[model samples]
Target: MGDTANNTENAPKKSFFKGVKSEFNKIIWPDKQTLAKQSAAVVAISVALGVVIAIVDIGVVYGIEQILKIG
Candidate 1:
């Protein structure tokens, strides 16, 4: 009776870990070429977004300075 209770307590955690491992094994990860292409796209998009944000910031600063008449 005591052993049965212990088994119930531990079995769920063990099964969960086993299921995770099985899922990881079954995953078909992207190939190197695909990964590289995706990474490059991400970097390009990030750079483009940064440039846009920078332009907006510069415009705002210039406008604020002009309004205040302060360099």
Candidate 2:
């Protein structure tokens, strides 16, 4: 019957949501102090990498300009 088919279709969805909720409950979230330290580390590393890339770019451009002057 159509009612049985509809029940079977919705059964998978209900079980999937239950599994998702169970998994969410098992997660151990980081505390605020740990979160702040991790965030600061990420920002500091990003800034340092940006500076390095800029320095390398400037060097490459300068080298190319010097080569053009020679040619």
Q: Against the true structure, whose lDDT is highest?
A: 2
Q: List the residue pairs that clash in candidate 1.
A: none
lDDT per residue as tens, model 2, 1-71: 88999888777677789999999999999999999999999999999999999999999999999999999
Per model, state how many residue pairs clash: 0, 0
Candidates in order, TM-scores: namely: 0.76, 0.84
Candidate 2 structure, TM-score to reference: 0.84
Give candidate 2's error at residue 14 in angstroms: 0.5
Candidates' C-alpha lDDT: 0.94, 0.96
Residue-pair clashes, model 1: 0
Which residue segments of model 1 deviate by more than 4 Å?
1-12
lDDT of 1 by residue, 9-69 (tens): 8766777899999999999999999999999999999999999999999999999989899
Clashing pairs in 2: none
Q: After superposition, how far is residue 30 of candidate 1 from its true place, in Å?
A: 0.4
Candidate No. with top TM-score: 2
lDDT of 1 at 52: 100
Candidate 1 positional error at 69, Å: 1.7
